[model samples]
Target: MNFTVVNKNICVDNIRMGDCSSASIFLVGDAETISLSAAFDTPPESLIVGPFVPLASP
Candidate 1:
């Protein structure tokens, strides 16, 4: 799954592993696309983003 920020037009893949004792999952994906789209409204100018490789899910 991925968290895509629309305003910034940026996305990075994410994979969350399951713990031995847990049955419930954390975030499957950034369901709230609207909020996520707005999260990068004020990114720092000095920040340099990158192309990242996501970890494989088990």
Candidate 2:
């Protein structure tokens, strides 16, 4: 999985893995490219993660 910040805002919180809110809002699991938008007055940052490749287990 890969992570990318699409925007920046003071109001926006720091993005990290295992957090569903941001990931669920942006990712749909089947897109080559995606974009994000902020709905609130403060410009919330956008994030994208996908194109995941599982590693081989030993």
Candidate 3:
């Protein structure tokens, strides 16, 4: 894979967020190469199925 990026003018005024998860990417500048990967494995014995419960307020 090859990429040629040319950025003349880039402006970011404001960025507002409430929550950011584990798989979140925030880029502001240019990049030549970027590769991201994720893997998750859950065994059958460790799987749990139950009702949903909201967390209490602090």
Instruction: Give the C-alpha miss distance for residue 12 in model 1, angstroms.
Output: 27
lDDT of 3 at 28: 86
Clashes of each: 0, 0, 0
Name the weakest run of 10 consecutive residues (lDDT summed) in model 2. Answer: 20-29
1-58 per-residue lDDT for model 1 (tens digits): 8665655454658755544332333553455433322345565996777875454447
Q: How many steric overlaps does candidate 1 have?
A: 0
**lDDT tens string, model 3, 1-58?**
8766778998989977655555667788887668999665987688787775543433
Better of 1 and 2 by lDDT: 1
True-vs-predicted CA distance for residue 17, candidate 1, Å: 14
Q: What is the overall TM-score of model 2 with all chains considered together?
A: 0.21
lDDT of each: 0.51, 0.50, 0.71
lDDT of 1 at 56: 46
- Superposed by TM-score, candidate 3 places the C-alpha of residue 46 at a distance from the truth, in angstroms, of 3.2
lDDT value for candidate 2? 0.50
Off by over 4 Å in 3: 1-5, 41-58
Is 1 or 3 the stronger prediction by TM-score?
3
Error of 3 at 2 (Å): 9.1
lDDT of 2 by residue, 1-58 (tens): 8797665444535644443342345442345666766465544465445686553433
